[model samples]
Target: MPGSTDERRAAGYRPLLFSIAYGMTGSVGDAEDLVQDAFLGLTRARQEGTEIVDPKAYLTTAVTRLGINYLRSARVRRETYVGNWLPEPVVLPTDRPGPAEHAELADSLSMAFLVLLEALSPVERAVFMLREVFGYGYAEVARATGKTEANCRQIFARARQRVAAGGQMIAFRSSPPERRAEGEQLARRFFAAAAGGDMNALLGMLAPNVALHVDTGGKAQAFGKPLAGRLPVVRLLLGVFRRAGILGVCLRPAWVNGRPGAVKFDADGSVTGVIELDITDGMVQAIHSVANPDKLAHIRLNPNEA
Candidate 1:
């Protein structure tokens, strides 16, 4: 294995595989599974000595095919998904030097953008992502998804129109004076109070229309569905924090879906929960909480543990 070129090629599959799989399956868990399968496919192809001259191109096509196939059936499967199905939230690594490249990756991974993609038909989504996110030409996208050049062009145009027509607008914008500050202050106050087990203070921060959505994928313990209204949200969070205990959880500012976000840290300062807030008019509109154990693998602390 010292100088094997095959090993190097295999190592390179993850970046493309992750992109394709994530574009296909909005769920990070599903995207990860698909990436594993893509690697396995590459491995088996190598075992048979298929002589992949352009490894990157081959992996791209293979992964795209797999993703497109999955998308063709994903709608049927997702119909049965519990609660309002949403894309998994991720903490994007932004240390990359090239601003354009980093921004593209970060933009593609946003929960807001992914949610917008949900409205697109599976084939349309594939064409749009392959063309837009990966910088593939219409003909190249066509080959990857088994569509004609004309069809790919049409789909891309339609997707562009949809985006321009506001079906897929960026969920948030550059924070202006009318937004961000007051909203963040309120969220910080609420999170601080909740972490301290102060129900009264927590309730005071929530708006009358506050809604909370917790996603644990049923594999982790969390609110089963989105809880709506201030009373319901406040009550639910109260029960949650009361049981979770005061572990000195602190909320730190973060960007989620290009919007204001916060991370909850345990007593030892390990992130445990990542919350995406939908703020309107400086009031908390909606809350999407990601506490799935699998999703929180990067999280180093437990809310139940100090």
Candidate 2:
């Protein structure tokens, strides 16, 4: 067995470290890589005879700074991205734990919430996630962010204010399995109407102000901007269905970010794109379609499950 310190550092804290990094970067692969790097850095510090008073604090600080640096580099790339960019979707288990167990984690894991975080600066985003989602105190957040406690508080306040003002605070709670089933049903009905070009049926399921945002990364065909209102979105989707030619294209419903979503598959069964719906009061409020090949690289669509 490994030593006690190794067990504590590697096993006890790895998940929390990953959560922090993911909240910052919104990329599962990048978060895992950053956590691994943090662990390796800790090993190097120990080997070099660096006196560590608190391993948890040291690791948190290292990971936060690393994530901040990574986000700064990533933002430059996003600036040139085609269409309305979205965070890479993360599929969650259908049988999720109760809200009492992982309520905050579930709250922050939604694609909409992650997209909201994109509006913040790197340091501001880090401060907000640490304080709001993880419930870290100002002192701890300050230590992790390498800022004064006052500065950290100011940053968090500013971030909260900006996010609230942006009106992107729609919270996706951890619902019971039956609620998920309802969402899946809604998605099925909507897509069926879309596939059949039933304008009346599709309009009945959409919110009056339903918004559609598609990201193709300039690699595929998509609108240059987001489409607003129900009728236009319905028409655009119908146009898309007509344009796809239907020879080998398939659409399947799956659970995306803990909500019902659909995937586009080629005849050979590879995933080509993903569509996540924000359903509110049994109506689709927003449609997020990501066809960016680079973003879809990590998504695996299971046709047999939702």
Candidate 3:
């Protein structure tokens, strides 16, 4: 029902809406579907002759509520999931420029941050993301979430405490330019060490308490539980890469969820897996690997010479 002007405006807001939805629900497909549903709701409202003073706010609210509902349903499924649950990886080109604002956005999109968010309840996650990540005021968050301003504040406070208790804070602070450069350099060394079977070099780059989490969803082979400690993780990774090498699998350096990572491709050029490294203090703190075919459906890569 929207005219050309209104349609164009709504289209322009798709990126922001997608970000919010994706932050709320760490699944790219769900986020995109929620955004489409929000726009469809807007169309219905306009067709009903309802005047919208601010389409952005309206659509945001719709998407948030929809995401909350979706999470309420998804939480149950996640409980009985086959193996370690992980968000679908968002891969980007390594050469992409990351300014300050972009870095902050990247932090929120990281696999570690999204995994941390799983601790909060649906409304708590929504309130926290609106206030802490997106910088929405209490009143704005209240209107978007259908809660009073005071209640929204309380929810955000509780969410913050929960996140902090998890040993991480959900702040939008960007890493220093030098620190980012160090992470990139470390990631390169990490992949090189693994490929070359340099066990000592790989051990040197990993944190003392480094943890590895692989999500295969019972589709591909992976550990039943999160593997902890430096030596075991290193051993597992080396074995996996060694086997992959025998099968003509290729590893391509990429940016996964804003962190230095890589994508694995099969001999036929199909995506086999994605790996994201959480680097801190110049060491790899966490290794997140996703091999579930369902989650890898969105990742497309051109065939490279094997």
TM-score of each model, in listed order = 0.65, 0.87, 0.93
- Top-scoring candidate (TM-score): 3
| lDDT ranking from best candidate downward | 3, 2, 1
Taking all chains together, the TM-score of candidate 3 against the true structure is 0.93
Residue-pair clashes per prediction, in order, are: 0, 0, 0
User: Which digits, one per residue and each the tens of the lDDT, describe model 2 over residues 161-266?
Assistant: 9888887677655777677778889998988888888999999999999989888888987779889998899889898876554656778776666567878877
Off by over 4 Å in 3: 96-107, 170-173, 303-306
Q: Which residue pairs clash in candidate 2?
A: none
The whole-model C-alpha lDDT of candidate 2 against the native structure comes to 0.79
Better of 2 and 3 by TM-score: 3
* Clash pairs, model 3 backbone: none
Candidate 2 runs further than 4 Å off: 1-5, 50-55, 93-107, 176-178, 242-245, 301-306
Error of 3 at 79 (Å): 0.8
Deviation (Å) of 53 in candidate 1 = 2.6
Worst 10 residues of 1 by lDDT: 93-102
- Residue pairs with clashing backbones, model 1: none
Q: Put down candidate 1 lDDT per residue, 222-287, tens digits, no spaces.
A: 656668887778777777777656555566665554445666666776666777776666576778
